[model samples]
Target: MSKEYLDGIIRRSLEIRNKYHELERLHHGSEWTVEEDALAYLTDAGLVGRNIMSQQQRWPKAGSQTELEHKLGENIWWLIVLAKRSGIDIKDAVNNFLTETEAILK
Candidate 1:
């Protein structure tokens, strides 16, 4: 995708995150800590695994594909948010990962 498209996606993701932070501040008197975000991300990551198990018929869940799709997207969002919180440039990080991995594979 074009950088412009990716920027739009990131903008939307951050906007959603801002709303969640606002809600958290109202409920908890503070935004969630980075550790809390990490925990939430891990929870979703576990659900992703569960969905994979269901997809493979190893789990008894009735709906896996849709939830899997959602979790996968949610994971990406979490990564983006985590990177922002940690002062990383997400686009550069992704680019470096892909480039280095592809070079190593080749």
Candidate 2:
């Protein structure tokens, strides 16, 4: 995707996250901690593994394609959100990783 499209996605994700934080503050008297966000991201990451197992026919219960797709998107969203919260630029981090890995392989 173009950087503009990716940035738009990130912007929208942050907006939604902020809205949720507002609801959380209203109900709980505070927003979620970064640790809590990490926990949530880990939970969804586990779901991604479970979905993969189901797809491989190793899981007892079949995973819905819709659920898997949603989880995948959520995982990426969580990563982007987490990076922003940690004061890291997600785009730059990704680019650096790619460049380094490519160089290593060469």
TM-score per candidate = 0.95, 0.95
Candidate 2 lDDT over residue span 23-59, tens digit each: 9999999999999999999999999988888877788
Best by lDDT: 1
- lDDT of every model, 2 decimals: 0.95, 0.92
Pairs clashing within candidate 1:
none
Task: Kindly provide the TM-score of model 2 when superposed on the true structure, using C-alpha atoms.
Answer: 0.95
Q: How accurate is candidate 1 locally (lDDT)?
A: 0.95
Give the total clashing residue pairs for model 1: 0
What is the alpha-carbon lDDT of model 2 when measured against the actual structure? Answer: 0.92
Residue 73 miss distance in model 1 (angstroms): 1.0
Q: Which stretches of candidate 1 lie over 4 Å from their true place?
A: none
